[model samples]
Target chain A: MNKTVNQKAWFLVLPVFVVVAFSAIVPLMTVVNYSVQDTFGNNQFFWNGVGWFQELLDPSTELGGRFFDALWRNLAFSAVILAIEIPLGIVVALSMPRHGWTVAFSLVVMALPLLIPWNVVGTIWQVFARGDIGLLGWVVNHLGVAYNYVLDPASAWITIVVMDVWHWTSLVALLCYAGLKSIPDAYYQAARIDGASRLAVFTTIQLPKMRRVLLIAVLLRFMDSFMIYTEPFVLTGGGPGNATTYVSIDLVKLALGQFDLGKAAAMSIVYNLVILAVCWVFYTVMVNADAEKKEVEA
Target chain B: MARIVLDELAHSYKPGPKGPQDYALKRIDHVWRQGGAYALLGPSGCGKTTLLNIISGLVVPTEGRILFDDRDVTRLPTEARNIAQVFQFPVVYDTMTVRENLAFPLKNRRVEASVVRRRVEEIARLLGLSRVLDRRANNLTADMKQKISLGRGLVRPDVAAILFDEPLTVIDPHLKWQLRSTLKEIHRELDLTMIYVTHDQTEALTFADEVVVMYDGAVVQTGTPDALFERPEHTFVGHFIGSPGMNVLPCTVEGTTARVDGQTIPLAGAYPDLPQGRRIELGVRPEFTTLAAKGAGLPVRVKRIDDLGRVRIARVDLGGRPFAATVPEGVAVDGDEASVILDPTRVHIYADGHLVAALPAGATAA
Candidate 1:
C-alpha cells in the first residue's frame, strides 16, 4: 500500500479547537489576567504582578494563613476518607451476591446515593442531622452522646465524614465488584484442589486480581474528597468558625464573597495547579505500578 | 492410589428430572481400578466431565454413592477427597512464578518448607519447566501454562487419583502428541489411576490403556484400544472410533447367515437366539472389507476414491446409501461395479444398536 498525505484533514479538527477555546482556554486566560492585575470598580484595572502569589505562600498574612489552613484541612479529609472507604468497599464487594437478581438489586441500591446531586446530598444530610428535627440526631441524643452537628466543631466534622462515606463508598464497591467478577471459576476450582484456605485464596488470588481497580478507586476518592465544596458548604456553611471549610469553600469566600479578585485568582491558579500536580503524581505512580505488575506477570 | 467406584451414579441439572432426556448422566455403575489408565471418550454433552467431577468429589451424584477403595465418600467435599483435576483451560496464578504455583498445593496443606521446595523443583524438571521456574506464569505459552496445571496436580504425594478434563484442548497441534506421551510417562512412573476425558478418538486411544466410549449419557463399551477398534460393542462406538467409521448396513439375521440389502453375509459363529422388534445391523470396519467379483457379494456403485498416503479408501453407493471400503496399495478399484466382502471374523451383529456377538472368520455361514 502506498501512503497518501492530505493537508485537507486539518479542517476536521476545527470543532475541537472551538470547544476548547470556549470551555477552557478563554476562561483560563481570564483567570491569568485577573491574577496579575488589580481591578476596582467598573472596568478599571492596575498591575499587581506576583504580589498576590508571594502573600498567599507566606502563611503569615491573613490571606496566606487561610489558604494554607484550608489546604491542610483538605489533605487531612482526603486521607481520612481513603482510609475508611477502601477497605469497607472491598468488604462490601466481597460479600455482595455473585449472581442472579440480587446482584442487580444490590447494585441499584448501592448507586442510589451517587444518583443524588451533590448539593442535594448536602441539604439532605443537613436537615437529617438536625438535633431538634432529625431522626439520627434524636437517636444519638437519646443514647446520651449529647450530639449536635450544628453547634460543635467535633460534631460537624463527624457529620461531614459520615455524609461523605455514605455518598461515595458505593463507587469504590462497584469497581471492586467488577474486578472480582472478571476472575474465572477455574481459578477458584484450582485453589480448592490446592487446599487453599479461604484467607489464602482472598489474599493471593482476589487481592492481586483487584489491584488495578483498587488504584482507580483510591485516585477518584482522593481527588474528589480533596476538592469537596458544595456538600460541606450546604451542610455546614463553613460552620462553627472555619472547621469544615475545605480549600474550594475558602476560595469561593475569597473570590465571590470578598471580591478580592487579584488574590482569589492567584489562589485559584495555585489550587488548580495543586490538584493537577497531585493527580499527575498519582497517575505516574499508577502507570509505574502497572509496569511493575506486568513484570511480575512476566 | 485407590480404586474409585461409582455405584448407580446419575445426575440431572434439574431437580426431579421427569424424563430420560432431562438427565445429564443416566444411571451408571462403573469402576476405575487402582493405577489403571483409562480414557472416557465421547463427544460434547456426553457426561464424561460430570463423571470425572464426581470421582474427584467436585460433583455429588443425585442417585448414587462413590467409593474409594471400598470406603463410601459420596458426600465428601472436594477438599476432603484428596483427588486432583486439571481442567480444559490452563489455569495458573498469574502473579506467582511457575515454581511458586507448583509449590502452592503443598504449601496450602502445610507441607514442610524444604519438602515443598524439593517437590516443586522435581516436578518442574519433569515438565521441562525448570528453566522458567522463576518466571511469572502469565508470560508463558498456553502449553507451558497447562504443564504448570499438570505439575500442581502431581505435586501431592497422597493424591488418590488425578483426572484430566481434555487438558490438552488448548495446546498447539504438534505439542498435543508430545503432551500425550508425557501424560503416559507420568502414569507409568507414578502408577496413579488417571482418567483422561476427551471427545477425540485419537487422543483417547493413544493416551490410555483402556478407552470407555460413551454416547447419549451412557457408557457404550469399555475395552482396550485395539479391542475397541476390532469390536465396538455399540454401533455408536463403531461409528465414533474409526476415521471414516465402520460401515453399518441394515440386516436380518437367522442362525449364522445374515441378509443385508438382499445380499447374503456369511457369519463365523452361530447366534442361536436374538430378540425381536428392534433394528438389526451388521458392522464391519473398512480395513476388514475387500473388493470382490461382481456376483460374489452386494454390488455397489463406486462414487469416489481418496488416496490417503498409505491406503486408498473407496467410497461406494449401496442402494443409494454411502459405504466405504479400505483398499491397500496396488489394488485397483477401476470398475464401476464393486462388490464389498466383509471378513467373517471381523464381523459383528447388532440388535437395537447393541452388540449381539462377534463371529470369527472360519465359522460356517449355515
Candidate 2:
C-alpha cells in the first residue's frame, strides 16, 4: 500500500487566517505606531525610539514605578486563582450525583453563574459587599468583626478574590463535571472490585482522568485572572491603595486616566507581551506534559 | 471458596409488590455450590442481570436472605461482600497503566508490594496482557481493555465469587470463543465460584456445567445441558434453549394421544387433568423433526430454505403457523407437499403454561 498526501486542505484554513490577520494584526500595528511616537494636540508626531520601554523597565523612573508592581501582583493573583479554583471545582464536581434528575438539576444550577456577564458579576458583588446594607457585611458586623472592604487593603484583596471565586469557579466546575460525566461507570465498578477506597478512587482514577480538562481550566482561569479588570475595578477600584491593582487596571489608569499616550501605549505593549509570554508558558507546559504522558505509554 | 445461598429472594422496585405480577424477581430459593460454574440464561428484561447484581451486592434484594457459607450477607455493601464483577462494557482505568489497573485490587487490600507484582504478572500472563502491562489502558483496543477489566476481577484470589454480567457482549464474535475457553481454563486452575449471566444460548450451553433458564423474572428450569434439552420443565425453556428454538404447534389432547393439525402424535404418559376446551400447545425441537416423503408425514409447505453449511434449516408453513425444521443436507422434499414428522417420544405437551409429560428416557429420532 502507498500513502497519499493531499495539499488542497490548506484552502479550508485560508478564511480563518485572513480573519485573524485583520482582527489581530491591524490592532497590533496601531498599538505599535502609538508606542514609539510622541503626539501633541493635533496628530503631530516625533519618534522616541525604545525610550518608553526602557523607562517602563527601569526601577528608578517614575513612569516605571507602579508597572513592575502590578505585573508581580497579576502573576501572584493568577497563581492563587488557579490553586484555589481547580481544587474547589474538582471537589464540587466529585460530590455531584452520578445519575438521575438530581444530576441534571445540579448541572443546570451550576451552569447558571457561568452564563452571567462578567461586568454584571462585578456590580452584583459591589452592592452585595457594602458595609451597612449589604447582607454579608451586615452579618459579619453583627458578629462583632469590624468589616470594611473599601477601607482596608486586606479586605479589598479578600473581597476581590471572593468575587472572582464566585464568578469563575462555576466555569471550572462545569468543565470538570463534563469530564467526569464522560467517564463510564465501569471504571468506578472496577475500582470498587479492586477494593479501592474512596480516596484512592479519587486520586488514582478521578484525578488522572480529569487531567486534560484540568489543564484547560487552569489555562482559561490564568489568562482571565491575569487580564482581570471590571470585577476588581468595580468591587475595590484596585484600592484601598494598590493592593488589588492588577495589570489591566493599572494599564487603564495609565492610558485613560493620565492621557500620556506614549508611555501608556508602551505600557500596554509590555502588558500584552507579559500576558502572551505567560499564556505561552502555560500552553507549552500543558502540551509537554501531554506529550510526555503519551511517550511513556508508547 | 464459599457456597452461596439465596432464600426467599424477591425484589420489587416500588414500595411493595401487590401480587406476583408486580415483582421483578419472584421469591427464589437456590444454592450455588463452592467452586462450581453456573450460568443464568435468559432474554433481555428477564432479571438474570438483576439477580447477578444482587449476588454481587450491587443491588440489595427487597425481600431475601443471602448466605455465604451460612453467614448472612444480604445487607452488606459490595466491597464487604468480597465479590468481583465484570460489567457489560469494559471499565478499565484509562489513565492507569495495565499493570496498575491489575494491581489496584491487591493494593487496596494492603497486599505486599512484592506479592502484588507477582500476582499481577501471573494474571497478565494468563490473559495474554503481559506485553502491554506498562501501557496506559486507554490506548489499548476495546477487546484488550475488556481483557484488562476481566483481569482486574480475577486478580483478587480471596474474593468469594466472581460474577459476570453479559461480559462478552462487547467482544468480537471470533475472540468471544477464545475468551470463553480461557475462562473455562481459568475456572479449573483457580477453582473459583463463578456465576456467568448471558442472553446467548450457545455461550451459556458451552461455558457452564449447570444452566439456569429464566423467564419473566423466575427460573423456569435449572439442569445440565442434556437434562434441559431432554426434559424441559417449562415451554419457555424448551423454546429458548435450542437453536431455531422449538416449534410449538397448537393441539388438543384426547386421553393418551394428541391431534396436531389433523395428525395424531402419541403422548408419553397420562395428561394432567385440565378443564375441557382449555388451550394446549405441543413443543418439539426442530432437530428432532424429520422430513419424510409426501403422504408419509404431516404435510407442510416449504416457505424458504437456509442452507447453513453442514445442515439445512427449512422454514415451513404448518396450518398457517410458521415453523422451522432442521434436516440434514441432501434430503429432497416436494416444494408443494412436503411432509415433516415429529418424533413421538420427543414431543412435549404444555397446559396452562406448564409441562405435563415426562418424555421416555433415551428417546431419539432414528
Candidate 3:
C-alpha cells in the first residue's frame, strides 16, 4: 500500500511561520547569539564560548553568588505568595454571593483588581505604603509598629508580597468561581439528602470539582510569581540591600544597568529554559490528567 | 418503615398567592402506606417533584402538616427527616470509591462502623456493585454511577422512606430495564415505603403497586395499574396513561345516550342531572374499541392502520374527530369507510374533565 505525502500542507503553514519568526524566533535567535559571544563597546563582539555560563554557575564567583541569592529569593517569594493566595482565593470564591443583584455586583468588584496594569498596581502600592503619606503605612506607624517599606527589608518583602496577592488573587478566585458555578444543583441536593455536613460537602464535592481549575491556578500563579519583575521593581527598586532582588530584577540590573551582555544573555537563556521546563511539567501533568478523566467518563 | 401522610398540603412559590393558579402544588391529602411501592406518574411541570421534595422535607409546604407514623415532621430539614432521595442525574462523590460512596450517608449519621460496613456490603451486593466496590465512583459508566447513587440511598437501614426522582433518565436504554427491575427487587426485599417519580408510563406502571397519576398540580387518580388502565378518573389521566391513551370525544349527554357530532352513543348507565352547563365527554380505551364492517357499528373513515407488531391499531375519523381503535387480525380494510365497535360497558362519561358517576338503579341525583 502506498500513501501520498501532502507536501502542500507546509505551504498552508508558511504565513503563521512568518509571523512567529518576526515576533518571537528572530528575537530569541538574537538572545542565543549573544549568549555565546562577548561584546565590548562600539558593537565589537568576540567569541566567549561557555565562559559566561561557567561563571554564572560557579557560586564562589561574585556573579554566581548574586545569581544564587536572587534565584533563592525568587523561589521563596513565589512559595510565600502561592501559600497565601491559593487558600485566600478559595475562601473568597466560596464566600461570593450565590444569586440575585449581589452576585453581579460582587463579580464586578472581584474583577476590578485584575483589570489594572501590573506597573500601575506596583505604583499604587508604592504610594500607598509610604509611612508619612499613605493610609496603610501611616495607620501602621501611628499604631506604633514603625512601618517603613523604603528602609526595612522585612517591610519591603511584605509590601511586595501583599501587592502581588492583591493584584493576582482575583484571577484564582474567578477561575474557582467559574468551576463552582458549573456544578449541577443536583449534587448539592443529593448531599443534603445524604445528610452530609457543610464541611463534608466542601471536602468531597466542591474541592474535588475545583481540582482542575486549582491546578491551572497554581501553575499560572507559580509562573507569574517566578518571573515577577514589574511590581516589585516599581515598588522597592530591588530594595535596601538587594534583599528583594529576585532573578528577573537582578537580570534587568545586569543586562541594562551594568551592560554585561554576555552574562545577561546567558542568564536569560537559562531563565527561559527553567520556565519552559516547569511549564512542560505542568502541561504534561494536565494532559495526562485530562486523558485519565476522559477515559473515566468514556 | 413508617406510614407517611400529607394533610392538606399545598405550596406556592410566591409569598402571597391569591388563587389556585398561583400554587405549584395544590392541596393534597394522601397517606403513603408503610412498605408499599408507589409511583408518582405525570408529565413535566405536573408538580410531581414538588410533591416529592415536600415529602423529603427539602421544601416546606406553604400550608398544612406532614406526619410520619403519627408524628408531625412538617418543618423538619432533610437530614432530620430520615428519608433518602435519588435524583434524576447520578450523584456520587467522584473522589471516593463505590464502597465509600455507599457508606457516606451511614457514616454521616454516625452509624457504628461494623453496621456501616455490613450495610454497605449488603447494599453493594444488592446493586450488583460488589465487583466495583473498590473502584473510584467517577471511573464508571453512567449506569454504574446511578447504581452507586441507589446504593447510597439504600445503605441507610433506618431511613423512613426512599424517593426516586426519575433516577433512570441517564441510564442506557438496555440498562434502564435492568436497573428498574433491580429497584423493584430492592423494594421487595427491603419492604420500605418507596415512591418512584417518572414521566414515562411504562416505568411507573411496571414498578409501582399503586400508581398516583397527577395532572395540573393535583392527584387525579391513585389506583393499581389495572385500575388506571380500566378506568381513568379524569380526562387528562385518560389522555396521559396507556400506550395510545384513552379516546376522549366531546359529546352532549341526555338520559343514557351521548350525542357526538350528531350521532348518538348509548351509555351503559344513566348520568341524570350531570349539573348545569358543563362540557360533557365520553372516554374509552383503544383496547375495548375495535374495527368491524363499514356499517356494523359507529361509521368511521379509516385514516391509517398502524401495525404495532403483536397487534394492529386503526387510526380512524369518527364524525370528523380523530380516534384510535384496535384492528383485528385478517380484517382487510379495502377503503376509507369502516366502523368502530366500542364496548358499551367500558365506556365512561366525563363532565368538565372529571368522571361522572353513574346513578344507582332506582336512585335520583341529590
Return the top candidate by DockQ: 3
Rank by lDDT (best first):
3, 1, 2
**Model 2 misplaced stretches (Cα beyond 4 Å):** A1-22, A289-298, B128-139, B275-278, B328-330, B358-366
Question: Worst lDDT window (10 residues) for model 2 chain A?
Answer: A185-194
* Superior candidate under DockQ, 1 versus 2: 1
Candidate by candidate, in order, the iRMS in Å equals 1.9, 2.5, 1.2
Candidate 3 regions off by >4 Å? A1-13, A294-298, B361-366
lDDT of 2 by residue, B75-162 (tens): 9888887789988898877668999989988888899999999999999999999999998887887678788888988888787788
Better of 1 and 3 by DockQ: 3
lDDT of 2: 0.85
Q: What is the DockQ of candidate 2?
A: 0.48
DockQ for every model, please: 0.57, 0.48, 0.78
Better of 2 and 3 by DockQ: 3
lDDT of 1 by residue, A125-221 (tens): 9989988888888788988998887789999999999999999999999999999999887788888888999998998789988999999999999
Give the Cα error of residue B13 in candidate 2, in Å.
2.4
Compare the candidates by lDDT and give the number of the best one: 3
Identify the runs in model 1 with alpha carbons over 4 angstroms from their true place: A1-10, A293-298, B270-272, B291-296, B334-337, B358-366
Q: What lDDT is reached at residue B77 by model 3? A: 91
Per-residue lDDT of model 2, residues A68-116, tens digit only: 8888888888888888898999999889888779988998898888888
